[model samples]
Target: MEDNYLTMDLLRFTTAGSVDDGKSTLIGRLLYDSKSIFEDQMEAIEKASKQKGEENVNLALLTDGLRAEREQGITIDVAYRYFATPKRKFIIADTPGHIEYTRNMVTGASTANLAIILVDARNGIVEQTRRHSFIASLLGIDHIVYCVNKMDLVNYSQQTFSSIKEELKTFSSKLRTKDISFIPISALKGDNVVNRGKNMEWYEGSTLLHTLENIHIASDRNLIDCRFPVQYVIRPQNDKFHDYRGYAGRIEGGVFKKGDQVMVLPSGFSSKIKSIDTFNGEIEEAYSPMSVALTLEDDIDISRGDMIVRKNNSPSPEQNIDVMLCWLSTTPLQPGGKYAIKHTSKDARCMIKNILYKVDINTLHRIEEDKKIEANDIARVSLRITQPLFIDSYSSNKATGSIIIIDEATNNTVGAGMII
Candidate 1:
């Protein structure tokens, strides 16, 4: 039992689709059927359902937490929920489905291991479906599950499911997804959600809960290139360990072991890893996403935003970058606009060199003539930074390849870009 507990991994996934596609309901059903919700929460939902004159308890209300969202019956911001099964722990990012909130969807999916693009069976394929699918592909989501929701509304017709599946396949051929699966589900009726519903007699695939528990996500992490961005310098003031000096940060890629030779970026200083220290004790090795302090064999000047990486396989440091920019601010992104660029632990000023093209999400067309980018618009742009940043392509490593643009005066994150 202890070994099984130790080995159970966590899966992070995001849901995206058009408005009223049952994205929230699917998540609520999963939580309710898995017994992850509290008794008081269930009673509260029942009370809300009564107030709304609902004959049955509304599961969708479970994730629509904000009063505005519950009153409006729409998800305006991203809702996150956590639960655990015997096989795996899960994190769900329930994103808004409206076209206007495309930037919210991108923020939720940035760290997801997989994406679930929901579609209403009655609606078949719509424009929003294409838009969300394109965003998923652009974000480098390798695994996609097209859940044809509201199967009950369509009378659980296999013919309808088949037709929608075919249409999605034809549309998604233009994407760069590696794997896509189709599952017909009725989020309201609990069909193929946590348990298989009797209405779908022809479907032979595993339930959604089972797939979430069993999907392989171990290969999602980049474990070949070592990149550790130092976030803090640890120096215990006065103690028996007075000479102790360590660099603390979360490892973004590859495996780092004790005694391994490493180099500090910007300074080009080399040293050997003396120890990997964690809260409990010293660890033999550490990998991506693990937060630990590392002591070096030699005393070196390393500060925040400085990266420690393997000498042979190091990230390229460059000042000019080509990126796919997702504009999130109301202010239009124009050529020569200046903003603060935040990449990992580094902060630098950058000027927009050029706007290559704005993409039409529905058709995936590059509108080269549109040099101005407004809210929720995605475009390819070039940027010139004041300092060289050690980076990689977003496809090569998401942790080191992404950046956020902040308005200098207001200090608001106005844009997110994936380095190309």
Candidate 2:
């Protein structure tokens, strides 16, 4: 029998909230109620809960894997957990909620299809909630869920959930995000997390798990603009059938198939697709997010960082690009600062030419007077690169429109930017 896991769809989502908002507990509850937790893991959590003198098992311990995290009672780093259900496989990124960890939330939300913003019913909405929601929208997440957690603390009041939901709707309107939903739950009590408990009788909606499995994410990918960034040039020196050369990389956008005429960037070389090679065999067609090695009918001087696209539909090349940058380092971003820019597989040097404005994440206002960008600051800036980059607007195609900045001296990623 064929394994069902092979065909199951995968979903990547992140959980963001303030400290002690039950982000970890909600993830733990999902794992526990869905029967994804192992016997040994459950035993350890049970023992730990008893050691801490808790009446109920501390489900947060399941995601707080680090010893320091458990000791401090906070999430200091991004913790990723994997679990599978009958319908879908899920990868959960439990991001830290503190203001200092804003960069971590950006990193976690970068690749997520949906974001769950947990709000404490007792506290209503706070600054951290707005901060995370803004960052999630800025990262281009399509779906957002306002999970009103700890409902038991507020007596499972419908008024509390309704009020919080309305506040969230009003706040999110200023951002680019559109799809938002509300769910009331008590993560500690496992109410309406994975299973619908009897506590909330007024709330009518699918459980969190059901919503996750049913959300239509297949349309999230860009299937119109063909973009293939060649990462490697493959050659076989062996004499078995020695004349084999292939360009290997992931398809970032659109569809690519054998015999399709494609053009290479910068070089303006044109070639027809010969075959799509895989470990198993040659594939007939490939689309966005598929990794394959393509052999061209005509061999041209193609190397890493060269992009392939349809001749009629190509990305614009620019040497001076405007971008919205999220500073990730402790050092403030200075104008004229030089850094290493990595866009797709292309790497080059760039200098910050101008700082247009800094965004006050709380208010979504552009602060033009204070152009200095500090750690976890988001700003719109202009950059001049040594070479031209083939790119698109982030709204058009995320895979081809994003860039990361690396500190030249420290060799660390200091910023992430999206082309405007």
Candidate 3:
């Protein structure tokens, strides 16, 4: 909400691909052509490129900001990059392409409105492509742009591009991805990147940057089930107003208004919404994704970790939860392991009750036997929380529907879970 450029409609997207698929180059091209690159940054990359004795500038270096990444010339960690175009402000999560870093892709894609899955045009769809697509589907990413990169190597042949696109359509159809688009691009040579390419006149779609800025992402929030997790209680006894009690937090789902009957979860205390307050003054209404505080007509003991919702639209409060977890720590996720489960503004201890299955990403097969889930591995597991959790399926709402497992001692996020 700061001084954003004209393109203030923020677009959060994640890029994913196999090694050498040119994901980084495509991102760098976007940032460069948009003139989001500063003179100093460009000069630094130019200097580094000359030091490496490269014939041309290594555009990928713009996103690979890690020192170890530069030395090895491979991305081993997720790098977040920000850039803006005249039509939109964008955040790109440049995740690693290696199969070992599947967890990184999930972490990056979890909050993404769209995902760009790149493929080498010459290679077609490979195992890694299938894996990335599957994970994207599992994480509920709505949009996918398949960039068939390295088109220069393929002679920019429309036949080659169409053939690869056909194969991709056939393979990706088996996944649960809701929407997908295809583009032929040479991230290194800049064909069909930021502008239309004369060589590929047969392709009629807009450039990657245009598509990103114009995508229909306005209808992504859940405005049906009202959820407000209390983050703080504001009680100020000022001279003008002796008694002021307000429960403040961000709305995770649905809408709220004055006179709407609300229920306090975990306690099941029913109350009528008296007024919704904001810094500007009392607002008549509020909805999902907005931060506001509410004052009930009759205070019935609402506190932090308590959720306010429409009585009939409230999510289930349960202790036993089934989740799909991606292991993130070096320590393996063992059965019966205990960790702190944090969901929304609530936190409690939970134990891994059972290992349901480990998904073979490429095959979409559930392996019931192999349960040795280590770092970067994803498995469906059951957990028992010390207290009740207010959750909806991850497919419905992303905020109240997901949780993270934190190590009690180190406080490291060891795993992320999507409630099933």
Per-candidate clashes come to 0, 0, 2
**Tens digit of lDDT per residue, candidate 1, span 275-352?**
999889999999998999999999998999999999888999999999999998887875798999999899999999
In model 3, the runs with Cα more than 4 Å from the true position are: 1-7, 69-76
Residue lDDT tens for model 2, 134-228 = 88988899999889999999999999889888988887888787888888999999888898999999999977888888888899899999999
For candidate 1, the clash count comes to 0
The candidate, 1 or 3, that scores higher on TM-score is 1
lDDT of 3: 0.87
Runs off by more than 4 Å, candidate 1: 1-6, 69-76
Clashes of 3: 2
Q: TM-score, each model?
A: 0.95, 0.96, 0.94
Determine which window of 10 residues in candidate 2 has minimal summed lDDT: 67-76
